[model samples]
Target chain A: MAASSTGLRYPSNKKTIYDRNINRTKTSELSRAAFAYLFVEMITYAQRRVTGIADLEKRLNTQGYPLGLRLLDLLLARTASSATTSPANLRPTRILPLLQFIHTTLWRHLFGRPADALERSAANAAEYMISDNDPLVNGYVSVPKEISQLNCAAFVAGVIEGVCEGAGFATDGVSAHWAEGAGGGEDMWPGKTIFLIRFREEVMEREEILGRAG
Target chain B: MRREWEGEKLPRVVFTLLIVSKAGGLIYNREFHAGLSKQDTNELLIIAGTFHGVHAISQKLCPVPPAQPPPSNIPTMPVRPSGIEVMESANFRLQCFQTVTGTKFLLFTEPQQPNIDGIMRRIYELYCDFAMKNPFYTVEMPIRCEKFDRGLDGFVKATR
Candidate 1:
């Protein structure tokens, strides 16, 4: 076999990202216009060769999955660095803390704010929902009437799934649905989105066992 | 009124802007406020190539510490090389900001300009929206979008 020299070269002595601290760096704000533009292109790319709206949402979900996986570690590292508590103490063990992590830490890191609301399904203990008013990714996006049922926020749902899976909480699926003006007519957020998160049966069983142990 | 407005205004701070591709090609170059001497297109191209070479060499020259044993189980991201960040002369300051994807934005500003980082970031944001997001724009290609130019113009004007 011939020797190949086509790989990328990096400077020696560079420390890996893990060795460095995450808290020292300030949160940098990105340009909304740019993000909106990139998202439009992403949707356009995903729109190609897709069977229907569900397929498009699936593509977006897949695109965001890897990001969620990477962000889980990064967000955990940030929390560990910022808080006075030890890293082990900061780890979310049960469903509540895990949901709080996604609602506050993950949401803040991604969109500069916590999710609007977090609620569990009254009928189904395994189901939870995170609500967001005016999701950043959908700021300038206007879904056509032909695909009005489609919610591009499915990408964010995928990220949520990644975080849950990374934390060892197996889930059946995470999906985004439009729930605009559900509370009342005087509601402020007309484009409110509700992300439905359903955990696997085994996960709920494990939670029950852990709950009893605690 | 126009004459009075012109008289009250100060000169522009941003002089020139250049966008270099990941492979170090000069994808976009524009002079907002011309200097005393303007370089021709060929000269600008050469300058871009030379700067790219220098940036790469500088990264190589960075000193590395002795190797240590890897940690057992923690996932770590690879640290990127920090190349030439800023260059200053009596006339102007050259600032370079590289994105995560390795595309570089080089901005030339007045020597005493404040918030160069902010300006560079805004420009980057504009590039992401106007250049990278444009369906007509192919990756690593020259940027020639009307919206990008207009956004940049507005930003530069606001800065002044």
Candidate 2:
């Protein structure tokens, strides 16, 4: 009787977040300029208290870290609960898969398009690249004479870096650079940015071990 | 008459928005669309400057007494930093909408513009949508963004 009571009182298994499903149609769409301007203001605001670019970048990273944490859950919920026939798989655990997810899924969600390219660094196993033909953050922003070296998207890079690090993937740091197009510069793509990702040595070793185990 | 106002084939034009701080400082500016007239643009800037002054005066004139203790009672909380300014002319109308936080939205429209309040609402909607939702966007500053411009242009053009 006690055993039956215990079984009935507390089920051994509980529903994980993965067990839930999301309604995909409710996702909100936003205007791009509003985001751009807002981001520009954010960077400018951060510019006030900080001593240098590194501090500003750190602030940006902090700003994005929470977002990354939120996105992880948001994407999972969206994928798991979708009524659509081709339900997307939930959160990716491994490094390659997570990178792929960011490149394709996250990029599409943010920019309405996939990243231009993603590749592992040949020289450094721990390094990766995510390229955007036009960076939304840089659009219409002509940095004045002073502080010209600053890329407002560095904050975004910090966020991406923070997210990767938070997800148990070891990251060294993330840096953003301008990627000039081959053809005459397109009118729409003034803010093209490429984010370079580097992981810690321990992470590379773990990746190798995981590769062998797989 | 209303047909031209609602015409779809107008040239691609964008209006940059700016919200100056109550202290006559440039607080917020966003170019919702591109290719607007220079005269209207200059007028909008002047309007932003003028309104900033007017908003300060209004806030000063309507001062409330201290509520809480000491520094806490320093007329904070419900502090309205500024107000709005709309510049409507024969060719176009520039709407400068401001919030209590001193943040402003400067929207440009055609001279025969109708439903301006709706247009302002849409601009505010865009501000909340893009600026607020974006983790990168800060509280206030000059807006220089291609996406915002493109989106604004698309929205206005569609409405037109």
Candidate 3:
């Protein structure tokens, strides 16, 4: 009789992570109601302040800013790992590219699509508009009658603001609004948020000089 | 690329991650993979509920330290309870990880799921990385973090 080993042997043939292929069969999914209720509580939690809509929006934005900082790093790492492209190379070293990244890559990553449009106001060069058809954060939030002007996504706008500021842009303020344009619907879809990004006038002057010098 | 293993039929497995509060409320839930059986889902929820109760009781039952002496040499360490359990049924295994703050993560997967403890650690890592760090994420509330969910999905998919 042949002697047998007491310990059970495991799979000895192990492959590297890079050699692994996508398991398309196993996908991830989450419930929407859970998020809605959570966001509702967040809005209520922020409502305890003794101030106006702007103050409330400000509080919400402050809450989201730190997240933007962390996401900037994590997003770059994830994108860099999977694809051949280096995220650090594609990273925004200047202001315009950063804003473009926010409108395109960052928006797409978070909300499953890119922002609808990005345009610098013809009347005010300092002001740039970043529009989204449906902002995920503000999807279920219904601002109370007293705080009608408040768009709860001001929290996410704040995060974007924090990200921009962290990236070295001198930002005046980041605000979210509900638009009744041709793209505006019901509780969820009608939330056409326009993140009004106002860069400091000095920053624009620097951009112009940089453009001329380059 | 290894094309030989692509056609190989491995045992089907799935995972569902949930965060339950001390009061037995569902704080966060995400199906990290889709191949889980219905029995697994029900078992996972039950496991989550049961662990939530156990953790609460454990925290309360934790004994307080006796009054300390004024001895300058000895440092008084706080007494706390560790609420962690690995539960297994016939179909799947449930790993319950709890933090000192009373937050718990319930991870359900195949009974023979390997590196499952590592997955739980990474899930906790993502919680710290995304959820706790997220300004939008309120303390002890259900996580509404898109990044946390996405990151967990990406990690599980990548490893699988």
Instruction: Highest DockQ: give the candidate number.
Output: 2
lDDT (C-alpha) at residue B109 in model 3: 84
> How would you encode candidate 1's per-residue C-alpha lDDT over A37-137 as one tens digit per residue?
77877888898999988898899888888888888888787777677777454667789989999999899889988999999999898999999988887
Candidate 2 lDDT over A74-106, as tens digits, reads 765666666453424755667888888788766
> Model 1 lDDT vs. the true structure?
0.81
Error of 1 at A111 (Å): 0.8
Q: Across residues A54-163, which tens digit of lDDT does each residue of candidate 3 receive?
A: 88888888888888887676666666666788644455766778888888777866666789889887888888888887787765444444556778888879888877
Error of 3 at B46 (Å): 41
Q: Is candidate 1 or candidate 3 better by DockQ?
A: 1
Model 1: DockQ vs. true structure = 0.06
Pairs of residues at least 3 apart in sequence or in different chains that clash in candidate 3: none
Candidate 3 residues B1-160, lDDT tens each? 4533643455435478889876676778888666565455566568668777776676576576557655778776766666547778887888888776777778888775668778888888788756764435667676776667667888888767
Per-chain TM-score of candidate 3, chain B = 0.71
Candidate 2 B-chain TM-score: 0.57
RMSD per candidate (Å) reads 14.2, 10.5, 17.6
Show the colliding residue pairs in model 1. Answer: none
Candidate order (TM-score): 1, 2, 3
Name the best candidate (by TM-score): 1
What docking grade does candidate 1 earn? incorrect
DockQ of 3: 0.02
